[model samples]
Target: MAELKRKVLTLSSGKQIRLYGNSVAISRSLEIGEGYAPNILSGNNEQPGNTSAGVINPYKLTPDELMELADFNIQLWMDLKANIRRFGVSSPRIFTGESGKQPTETTGNKKTGLSSRQQATE
Candidate 1:
């Protein structure tokens, strides 16, 4: 599979902006993989176009943080359902996780278990 390319935009104040595009077609001959390239030459103009003035910083979060954010988002959706239920809006059921029985050994394995060792020593 072809990797996506990261587009770079240079602002007038010398700040650089990086973005990833899904795909870019350059005729039927040449194709480039996705990544952040420092130098992007202009096609016709001598200078590159400046970045937009009001661009904001993108959100960066770890996997655990993202999961917590998703949980909050689901809660917000559930709260909003009260307003739209009269118009046939249904609250979607969201499952956060599952519960399972704790594993336990019944025979000789139980006596040889780590918990048994702690109890025997005590």
Candidate 2:
């Protein structure tokens, strides 16, 4: 099941906007579907072409905040990707579990197995 969570973001001006889903899932999807570059080089004439990500809408985030949110999400994703590589998490879902039990996981092993990921924290 999709769990809905809330996040309170305080802007530079001391205004707050409540974002949902732990972190805005919108950030990443928008960054891709909206053609936002997380890193903008100096002297670049173009500032990301489109602001619309056809399917998902950024509910209450302003254009400026949306850009910030994209960078936020990009950094988080990159960190996670690097950690996944370092830890060699090939099938994370096998331990996390999705809809059904993983094929290679046995009931006894699942109960007794202690993985190193259990020790790592963000």
Candidate 3:
């Protein structure tokens, strides 16, 4: 496996955003694969006031637009949290050994002290 790298983006408000491998993984999972069409949020111009008053209102998004934004926000938050948990802290070391020997292995060509499946049988 390639060594994992971290990316941190600092927002204008001074909040730090950290992205790890898990973040990219989650994004890939949510992406629309080949042969899938993306949904486009629709919007239309709305005149809320009387036309005779000479007032023109701005464009407004339909209900689907609001829902899409909400869903996107929720997923973004979830992915952020998941990535942080996956790589934010260093994991504890399970074994230690000197330079020449593998930490999980000891003396013999018998694969001494290893679990049955890990040991090579003659």
lDDT of 3 by residue, 1-122 (tens): 22223555455666755654222232323221122122233223344753443322233556677688668757754654554565453422221232312134333445366555446552
Predictions in order: lDDT: 0.39, 0.43, 0.41
How should the candidates be ordered by TM-score, best one leading?
2, 3, 1
- Could you tell me every candidate's TM-score relative to the true structure? 0.22, 0.27, 0.27
Alpha-carbon runs more than 4 Å astray in model 2 = 1-60, 90-122
Better of 1 and 2 by lDDT: 2
Best by lDDT, which number?
2
Q: Rank the candidates by lDDT, best first.
A: 2, 3, 1
Alpha-carbon deviation at 118 in model 1, angstroms: 71
Please give the TM-score that candidate 1 achieves against the real structure: 0.22
Question: Model 2, range 35-102, lDDT digits (tens) per residue?
Answer: 22324322233448755433234254467977896687676556545545654566442232232232
- Model 2 lDDT, full chain set: 0.43
**Model 3: residues with Cα > 4 Å off, grouped in runs:** 1-58, 89-122
Clashes of each: 2, 0, 0
